[model samples]
Target: MSERAYGEELMSEKILFVDDDINILQAYKRQLRKQFDLHTAQGPEEALKLIADHHNFAVVVSDFSMPGMNGVEFLSEVKKISPNSVRIMLTGFANATNAINAVNEGNIFRFLAKPCAPEQLALSLHASIDQYHLITAEKELLEKTLSGSIKVMSQILSLVNPVAFSSTSRIKSYIKHMVETLNLPGKWRYELAAMLCELGYVTLPPETTSKILANQPLSSNEQTLFDAHPTVSASMLDHIPRLEEVAEMVRRQQSNFSDYTLTEESILADPSTLGGCMLKVALDFDRLINTGMSLPKAIQSMSNRRGVYYPRLLQCMESLSKVDRSMEIRPIYMKDLTVGMIADEDILTVNHMLLIAKGQEVNLPMLERLRSFAKTTHIIEPCRMRIP
Candidate 1:
């Protein structure tokens, strides 16, 4: 709660978007409102009223150059109340200065230019969501999951950014909805496919999490890098062949979203699978909500998303996220003890192991006398040696 920068991704809980222009509001809703759970306001007063209701919008984006309240002033006030919610400024050339001031004094995230492209807006909002998740996770780590190192890593990763952990949950929700809504072939492969689609992101830079979540169009260089992420992810699990099929699914989630034709023998989509479409759209929707599309707007946009996603899959997403949306808790704890757990400090553990590996024993004097007679791999897994 000390407000230091975090190195993980965090997707906030909800979003609120405000603007004076009805057209802008409507355009945003048209683009992404249905894709996310959204709350919208036409002006500062209405926005303030919504905030007063304690809706806890994780990310708030406002247009600059409003009638009475400018973007900076309105957001400045918002920062005071929901100090945790990420504030973003959307401004034209005239309001650029004010937006920068907001970024400085208000501790706002990056500012966007007026008439912001849907992709860019979505990316920024996703970043805000990521930040929120990180802070929440850190707090949870302090409160709960500090006991075991493995548990702490899990809680920190999941709580800080549900995007990583929620990949499984979100895909599970998608499968349940798709199986019921689309009435397609239900297979464990589909379920497995959904869960592991984003495993590639584990090795990705935290900055790239927002970019991927936002579904922002990637540049040529970025696209190439992203294209290789699947391969990178697969390498991590190569030691466990039980997960190879799942790795294949993750690698192809984005690759199969094409108009190109495929043969029946091909793994690519033929007529198009609702399950496949849902994952991408859901991923995008999650980003849009983070970007600041009010819940209603996000839902509306997802509903209105024509050829971008299957109608049946979108319907399921709408039903699942809007109604009976369950929030999972992040657990953590702390304790002192023992060896074999992941060491917190690398220098101490690594150097000691290295010295032993180089034929220098330093544990018990008896062990040194024994090792003086024989030399081999000193440190072994399930290291059973405590003394000579």
Candidate 2:
């Protein structure tokens, strides 16, 4: 194959063409079949069904003069169904009103007049595919870079505010367990939100965090500051690319489900909001556990506050506690440290300085840092860590 043909083949080949006329659809298939993997639908309804069945179309080209739904309206729905797909409008009459609607309402990438040349249509389709690739590539890049930066920020917070960061780790573990038990989607976002949910505490006085976590009475001003941490954390993260959903989850993390009646079905309907509720429960449970309450007592205490937590969530916690109780801790040499392992106790040097805190989740960066520290100073062998 020629280089250009090879490139087109490698690009997004999936395309959808919607028109009420069978002849036009036939012509599209005849001309574009060799260059793209095409799907045709007689009308907007059929097009919607096709979209529902196959969700990964990279481009959707719709005829403007349809029976029930116009191309603009159909494309608007297409945007909701698959925002990354490039949209194009084909109309018999090229009017200013239709063109404006196509651009403004549908966010169409191209507006082509009917009876367009085969070559022109092919070019437009290729360009649309290119646009889709560009959009998805940028989105992937933004998500990865933003996620890494947040992870590093959380690691720094762990060092700076050990008390608050330690609580974050524990909550994160609980959320991981809960999400897995529920088999929910977007587990990464939930975990990330849990890790950084308490980031705002870095701005507050350490004493304030200590008092809040300990359930000690705080002065009016201190209580106000504590209440503002979620909003502060959200604001700090809102501008980072692709973190809007995570930021919103953090912003609502402190909400009480008691304010409104929400069933498991309703909460599960929106995973992001469900994540916020999960963070709330996990944080509260951790706070109770840290304040000298036993595991069973902590669960009982949160369970007693009926509307404060989603019942389904508390049930997941109960399940997690059983699994946690059955797990055993063992000593593993520092050289054998692996990611995802939790330190059962603090790893300290002969001089009694803290190396890694108890309950800190082992990760690559932590492992590398420990290895480097071992080079300069001595770390006791056979470190104790917990595993499930």
Candidate 3:
């Protein structure tokens, strides 16, 4: 096949046609089968079931006049279930008001009169498929570009202030576990925020960062700067594409749950603030652990703070701690090291200078550097990593 044909085939070829009338569905199958991979449903309910089973459909066409659910209503549900799928409304009794309502409320891509010719329908389907591809492509491109920029920024921060960034890898691990435990969507943003949360520390004096990481008491001025880091990080990330939500979460990471009068129910209702709560809990837990508190003691300390951390978040951490203890840690040579593996303990040079910290997730660059370093300076043989 040609490139364009192959691309189209790889993209979503499935188109769903929903109508109460059997004859109309049969006509659609006969007319659309050659140009499109078609699926027909008798009503909106059956169409929804199909959508649930196979979540990808390039376009969904529904007749406006149906027995129980109108075309507008069905399309609106489709928008929620699969927002990327293009929607079209077909009605025998077309009115200006109905068309406007369908377009506005249901987000319908096209409003077709019942006597839509095969040619017109085909053109509409082709346009809808093109639109679906366009939306998905734009989203994928934006995510890739933003993620790459963030990763570079994080590496720079790591090099500039190793102490501040040392704990960040651990913070990211915690955030990952919390997100997975809760089965939250859009985990990339949370993980990204965790990785870059300490970006603002790059501006702090090296000695100040050292003190903070060592859990030494900071002077009033130093404390103020430390507290302001979240806002600074948020400001730095705010202008990046698709990072608005992540920035907001970072800005509110230090906020106490009791600071706001809003109940958990209210906060959970708004996804933006809920993300902040997650960040807050993760940071607090990391701080407690960094202070040399035992896992149980850290959980107890956060619990004693009452409204400082969400109760469910604390419980998730406690559960994760138990699971983490059971995880097997094994030693491997530097030559065998690979990406996506977490370092079980700090990897240091012969003089004991920290090269990679415990709980740090290894990447390609770090792996390459370790391999190069191993040739001259003897690293403690058999570097340990958790097999997760």
lDDT of 1 by residue, 33-64 (tens): 64455678999999987885663788888887
Worst 10 residues of 3 by lDDT: 319-328
Per-residue lDDT value at 220 in model 2: 96
Using lDDT as the measure, the top candidate is: 2
TM-score of each: 0.35, 0.74, 0.72
For all candidates, what are the clash counts? 34, 0, 0
lDDT of each: 0.56, 0.82, 0.81
In model 2, which runs have C-alpha deviations exceeding 4 angstroms? 1-13, 20-31, 40-42, 45-55, 167-191, 203-226, 239-244, 258-275, 281-328, 350-352, 372-381
**Candidates sorted by TM-score, best first:** 2, 3, 1
lDDT score for residue 156 of model 3? 59
lDDT of 2: 0.82
By lDDT, is 1 or 2 better? 2
Clashes of 3: 0
Instruction: List where candidate 3 sits over 4 angstroms from the true fold.
Output: 1-83, 104-106, 115-130, 214-217, 259-269, 290-297, 315-354, 371-388
lDDT (tens digit, per residue) of candidate 2 on 162-231: 5566566678789999988887645778888998898898878968876887778999999899899999
- Tell me the lDDT of candidate 1: 0.56
